[model samples]
Target chain A: MSEAVDAFNIMVYRQLKRFVRAKSRLFGSIVNPLIWMVFFGLGWSSLFKGSMAKALFGGYSYLDFLAPGVVMMTVFMGGFISGVTVLWDKEFGFLKELLVAPASRTAGMAGRAFGDALVATIQGALILAAIIPLARDINPGGIPVTLAAALLTGFAFTSLGITIALKISSMEGFHIIVNFIMMPLLFLSGAFFPIDPLPEWMKVLAYLNPLTYSVDLARISMLGSGSMNPLIDTVVLAASSLILIGSAALLFREATID
Target chain B: MDAIVAENLTKRFGELVAVDHVSFKVKQGEIFGFLGPNGAGKTTTISMLITLRKPDEGEAWVAGLSVAKKPAEIRRRIGVVFQDPSVDRELTGWENLWIHGVIYGVPKNSLRRRIRSLMEFVDLWEKKDTPVKHYSGGMVRRLEIARALIHEPEILFLDEPTLGLDPQTRAKIWDYIEDIRRREGTTIFLTTHYMDEAERLCDRVAIIDHGRIVALDTPENLIRRLGGDVVYLHSSSDRLEELASMLSETGLASDYKIIDGKLMLSVRDASKAMPEIFEAARKLGVKISEISYKRPSLGDVFLHYTGRSLRDSEGSWKETARIVVRRRR
Candidate 1:
């Protein structure tokens, strides 16, 4: 047990050092979401105000309606970027070194996932601070719960990213997958708009995507209103997280570390 | 007792066989060299022995634990330095060593002292706080050796330890390897394409070609078997076979071959046989454009066993094929 802890700590320390060294990556994780909140939210406020957005959000502004979605976006992008680090390690031969070391594969995956989740949380928090003053209707009293949701959601998506990174053979393939999977999931999750009025087919796809559940939960917790039941969304998000996290661990266990 | 042993070990990737029925044993405290051209399964075999890769057939025991069944035990008992550099470029030298020590379950107090001693030994104590990316190639290689030794395993495996380094640095690495062996009596298992490296460091060397051990013996014994002298006579024309027959008839030398328009022969004495060799060349009207004779090096031993030079054979067709297969999705 101590050995496993040591391995996890070492893995975490290594990743933290890498993150510190790569400042551009730190900026990239938060910059995307901050842009969405500031430019898009302000631009869309006059267009989306005093409609269902106001009613469902308890008279909240359009900027408030968009805040949770941007937070979830920050988590998702941060999680996806985490996988690129694993790919870098693979290309640089450090992955082989870690695999050959006297540590369990479980510990290795856990450490990497934790590091990714930590980065996601930090980026999400920073973006949230930037978005909070802009979204006047948001209740600052829910900050603690919102932060918890971001951490769990980030962890779930980070695990998913790591699982994909482990199975994919090359950086090019991973990039193709991120394009095919991440972008579409973000669109269908209703990050820019509510999912209630979408076509039946689109609704089903959104339900299937775990990101939608995360966005819905974030929306309900932060803005206090969304079309979906907040309780049901939380449950679904937690279950989806468990499934992906379990599968990631299994995939990491079976992965050939070479 | 043998520090490492393999019995008919085999590993396959899909239909391609990487390591085929390979078997060998290294007695405790011997610097055994596993010499092979790239893709002759040297790294694959070493990975299996270190419990990093699973063998498809047969079994290997490292420090008395079956590598197939008791990989964790084997991992605990062995240290590995991979061919590519493994040090974390982001971490300082001392931090890298400390992290490795901690992961390997070293006590904190002991680790502090070990890190200092190891850095000092590798001549990196002055730069211990600097990130590895700042270190020279030779310094990183030495730090890797230090990292491997931190756990103090009974057996250590170094895969191409001095590859891609200057000759001077390579010799320095060789000196460090020898010093470690003398000081600690660690069983060293290393792989190299450099004949001089094998000849200098390894107590016994196995020359592997095409996934099979072609020759296994002490370097001196392998060279002695090749008659201690190599004579290369490059002819102007492709008349090597004819010249070889004529030289045989003159009763000057034995064990000769005509390869690539060169008449390569081995003899006990080159000084005494040169006169007769020249006479035979003159009689056959063979133009000896280049005539060179030297004490039989490991290159001669490799040529004797595989009929090809080590330097030429590395990164050959087999390695190219392996890379193609490895790169395939």
Candidate 2:
């Protein structure tokens, strides 16, 4: 038990140390959401006022409606980019070193995924903190719940992203997956705008996406507003996290480091 | 007791046999060299023995634990240094060792001292705090060796340890490996394409080719088996076979073969055999362009066993080389 705790601390420290060394990567994770919040959210605010935006965001203002989406966007983007560590490890041959170590496979995956999820949660929280003065309606009563929602969302998405990265063998394949899956998941999950404004098919697909539940839960926690039940959203996100994490662990079990 | 024992261990990828019924044993404290060409399954065999890859048939026991059934047990007792630099470049050398030590269940009290000693052993103590991304190729490799040694396992496996490094750095690594072995009596399993590396460091070597073990013996014994001296004679292409036939007829040497536009003849005494060799060439209308007599090296031994030079067989980058290591649950 002591060994396990030591291993976890070491793994977390390793991640933190690497992150500090590669501040540029951390910056990259932040830039996308910041741009969306400042430029897109502001620009679309006037264009999406009242009826059109209300229909999409359950009657919230465009800027207010977009904050939760932006938080979820950060989670999705950060989660997808978490796989870059795996790519870097492969290229640098550090993956083999980690595999040969005495740590369990579950520990290895959890260590990395937890690091990414933590970063995602922090980035989401920071974005929320930055936008708090702008979105005055965001309740102080919901701060803890909003943070919990953001963390759960980050954990779920990052696990999925890491699993994809582990299963895909090449850098090119990883790129294709990120571009094809992550972008669509982000846009359709109502992160930038609401899915109700989109075609009927996309609305259904958005509901199916795990990111939607995260966004809904985050919005409800922060603004005390959401179309879906908070319980349902939490359940969906939690279930998705478990399934993705389990699949990743299983994939790691089967895959051999060359 | 044997540190490792592999019996008819085999692994196949689709239709291609990566390791074919390979068998060998390493006693405790022996430096066993696994010598082979690029696609000769040296790494594959090592992977199986290390429990990184599961074999399709047969079995291997590492430190008395079955590689197939008890990989965790095997992992606990063995250290591995892959051919590729496995040290995390983004972390400091000290951080890398610390993480590895922790993963291996080293107590925090002992971890710091162990890491310092390991870094000092690998000559990376001064640079321990510096991130490995700033390290040179050789420094990264040294740190990797240090990382592998952190747990103080009874056996250490180094796959092509000095590949693609300058001779000076390679020599330093070899010296470090030797020093570690001497100090700890650790059983070393090393793989190399370089004959000189095998000759210098290995107590015994197994020459593998095409997923099969071709020869297994001490380097000295293998060279001795190829005969005392190797005579390199460059002659006209037309008379190459004729010269070989004439040498065969003289029966002065037990082994003779043509390689790379030159006829290499092995004999007991090159000084006495040189006259007969020249006479045989002359009678066959062979005009010798270059002639040199030297004792048989591991290169000669490899060529004799595998029918190809190690240099020619390396760095193909064929699909066979793309091995993925997945965690086993």
Q: Give the C-alpha miss distance for residue A194 in model 2, angstroms.
A: 2.4
Question: Residue B163 in candidate 2 has what lDDT?
Answer: 92
Docking class of 2: acceptable
Report the C-alpha lDDT of model 1 over A132-248, residue by residue, as the tens digit. Answer: 788776778777777777777877888888777777778787768778988898889877877777899998998898888778778777877667787787788788777877777
Q: Once model 2 is optimally superposed onto the true structure by TM-score, how far is the C-alpha of residue A205 displaced, in angstroms? A: 1.2
Minimal lDDT window, size 10, model 1 chain B: B315-324
lDDT of candidate model 2 versus the reference: 0.81
* Displacement of the residue B91 alpha carbon in candidate 1, Å: 2.8
- Writing each residue's lDDT as its tens digit, candidate 2 over A33-124 gives 88888898889887887686677667788888888888778877776677445776776777776676656777677667777777778877
- Poorest 10 consecutive residues by lDDT, candidate 2 chain A: A1-10
TM-score of chain A of each: 0.92, 0.92
DockQ of all predictions against the true structure, Cα-based: 0.47, 0.47
